[model samples]
Target: MLAPTHYPLEYHDLRLVLALVRGGSLAKAADLLGQDVSTVFRAIQRLEKALGTRLFDKPRSGYSPTPLAEALAAQAQQAEQALARARQHTLGGEQVQGCVRLTCSEAVLQALVAPALGAVLEALPGVELRLHGGPGFANLSRHEADIAVRLCQQPPQHLVGRPLATVPFVLCAHPRLLQGDGGGAPPWIALEEGPGEDPTGDWRRQHFPAARIAHSAHGLHGVAQLARAGLGRALLPRWLIEAPLQVLDEPTVACASTLWLLMRPDCRHIPAVAKVFEGLARHFTTAANH
Candidate 1:
């Protein structure tokens, strides 16, 4: 046989192999790479052809890597680490420039981050911030986001985080709704405890078992709006209290949770990501003190 065809692995090829090794199957690998299963399959085929060797076995359970594939994947991981270190060194503090993705719950975004975004952008003129606001937490391990702001009793162990503030829960209602109800417990605008746990819901149920839930929302922003609309009384985070919505003194629950700013350890080394992280940390730190 002629000498085996020699081909060098590309950056994308390394990423693909590592993703497949970590994800175990094409579908999971596609999800990690943000590509379709078919695309990932074709890429694997191309990589195998280039190397002139079978890299994976099509087992019933999943794609199992061969001995050579595992060795190649290990090298790919080392390469990735080296590249990350190089980027960290190349992008110095003054040279901070890149896009940083930030993810957080909608309530936090509207009340905190969004309002202060102008100042953040002003400080880091060369950096771009992409904010994602939703109820669910973004998977940082999958590179879904570079930074995250989360309100929780305890943050994930894998992420590096700092507690920013203590979010206190308060019962609020529109002046008009309270006036119409005439001093008794007005119908409740309940907060729906979605996938993430919020202790405030438990506090509401434990304290106001007989209260009727006239309307419900999945987030603090939604519940605040419902309360503002004179729909019903809502137990909400104190930060959400605004014009027209009055905080009720009765049934004061000592419910609270900490707000945390988090990021993957590897991402913290990037200049742009670190700059934004510092800016936001300062914002929340100042807000908490006041």
Candidate 2:
């Protein structure tokens, strides 16, 4: 058997192939790439001819990549990243100034992200920062966020997650709640009912296992509000409610939560994102230790 004649594939052809693989159909890929369907189809055909193999098999569901195409897709992804870095370098290295979108929990935003924003802005005046605060994890692999702060025991695989700090938990209450209570230690207000016994109520059980909860809340913020209202004592992150509430020494529990900064391995080479990552790492590392 003779080996097929190999024709070098251009970057455009590689991009078209990758788009088709991702979009699942020629028409969809065309829409994403802003090209006519015929043009996309022609590009795929040319790619197949050059490689001497069929790249896609059309099915009732959608276009599915063949084994060879699947293998090529991985290579194409790396090539695309390399090309982006090359373009950035060619742009005189000054173009690293731009907006970076970050996602993290509300507590993280308050404790770490908000404090570091000033330094980052001063260093890169052309760069802007947009923060997305929530609990659910953002998909960094898909570029949903340029960076993320999360609490986890293990960092995600294929992504760089550096340990920034270990946040400790503390039991606190409003001053008004403790006025009538004795210094010896008052009865506590629990957050939830109990764990395993009720999945929806486990959050309460986990945080306030000893206290008798005066009010039940669905989220930590609501629970914090209830605590402030003197409803009951609650366990909360020290960094979040430290300044606002009176820390109860008697019921104080030293539970720890790990803080991590997550980013794609490939993104570390992007100058703007890289600089932000470095800044965050330095800021959090120092903050965590202190």
Candidate 3:
């Protein structure tokens, strides 16, 4: 018999075993965990050796958990729950502490979420906020981030998501461009295909289907700059465009986008994640209504 501590299985090993059981195959488990098959196999071997029991048996259909493995899985699940509880207690129940990974767009990070989250950080000194800002959405289902702020037409079904607010977009032109002119010809430079798509380059096709682009960029900052330089009218989030840029008073051209907060259903209950979500919701709701 192997001693419990001799070939000890770490928390990750236990998690890998659980993933394998749930996924039903080495390759499937690896895919789920974002790991290679060899890594999953190694973890399983380590876990089985530690317990001196064969946890899984190969079958025609796929790998099946043995009776001993099933029993061990039940125990492991209980242990995992206990550990999670202990972690919560150690941090302070219902009070957020520790690090939280957040994903958002550059404009939101610089203009809204970052500033609002600064208040949260000040309130909770022990908490760490890891912000990832860019165009693409992070994979929350795989634990890529603990919380996400996304602007999307529809939220994914597997995760818990809430509407933060509906942010309005405005068509703005540089003061010089609109000085005595009628905002130039048609075809304004704009954000390419919504927030989920790339926000750079010549995106006139989507916003100004009939207009030609004088310049293009991959970020809002660049587009805003070009518009300010009288390159062309640009579509941008109202929050990101500061004073001096004149909003084109065309009711037919304006559009609104929905902002959403998303989190894995499992992590939604985490105090840290919950606190941030509440704070963001409150801030955005108040801003939008005002």
Candidate 4:
């Protein structure tokens, strides 16, 4: 097999391939690449013609990448990372005027980061913070995100950052639902099973063996909303505690999860990334105090 570099492929072509491989669908790839689905489809067609082989198998669910496509995506990711590092080093000392992409869960964005945005912008007038909210962590090594705020027991060792807050789990529900001891297997609001391991779900199952799951949501944000609606009791981070939802002290929930602010080692020196990093760290740290 000819090496991917041996083929007549442009840098952008490789990026499209990488986006497709990561996204698993034409619409998702287009969204990541900031292109239309038709454009991505046309480009893939052209790329396949140039390479003289099929790169993906189109299935009902999503795009299944061929081995060659996977190899090309790997090379593209490495090249993107190298280019980002080179660019950061070359312009590390320049004014912090470029965009800094920050990725975190929707819950964090709504409860924490979003509230701090105006202050952050006021402090760094020249910088633009692009917020990407999702359940999955963006690949920092691939330059998918400049910074990430994650809620986990321990962040990946490769990333560089500190835990901003120790987030404990809590069982909460609408005030009306918790009129009494709130016992007897009350309805539960559960997080739907996904790609990663879920300790909270396991805790719920182990603790509440006969509990009925009345509602299911993708993440804590949705679970909280469901709890607020008096649908069921939800196990959420202590940070998410708010009005209409009161904590249930009897069935004590405990998980030593921490909120971490992380970034790539190569990004530490970039003025915009550095400034945003410091600002976010301070914001979350101060909030954690109260």
TM-score of each: 0.74, 0.61, 0.66, 0.72
Candidate 2 lDDT over residue span 65-135, tens digit each: 88777667677768866765676678775565655668876656776688887886677765667677764
lDDT ranking from best candidate downward = 1, 4, 3, 2
lDDT, candidate 4, equals 0.78
Clashes of each: 0, 3, 5, 0
Each prediction's Cα lDDT score?
0.79, 0.67, 0.69, 0.78
Q: Give candidate 4 misplaced runs (Cα > 4 Å).
A: 3-8, 78-92, 96-101, 116-129, 134-147, 154-162, 180-185, 195-199, 251-253, 262-279, 282-290
Clash count, candidate 4: 0
For candidate 2, what is the lDDT? Answer: 0.67
Put down candidate 1 lDDT per residue, 1-290, tens digits, no spaces. Answer: 12277786688998898888767789878976889999999999998888888888988998888888787777776776667557657876565566788888899888877876778778888787767797766667655677988777888799889888887888888988767545666899876756443767777778888888889888778888999998988878887889899998875647888888888786666667878888888887787688
Best by TM-score: 1
lDDT of 3 by residue, 54-149 (tens): 788988877788876665555665665566557779877465565667888777678778777866667666566767787565557545577888
The CA lDDT at 54 in model 4 is 90
lDDT of 2 at 122: 78
Q: In model 1, which regions exceed 4 Å deviation?
A: 1-7, 16-41, 48-81, 84-93, 180-185, 251-253
TM-score quality measure for candidate 2: 0.61
Model 2 / residue 50 / CA error / Å:
16
Q: Candidate 4 lDDT, tens digit per residue, 49-107?
A: 78888999999998988999989997886776666557657756644565788888889
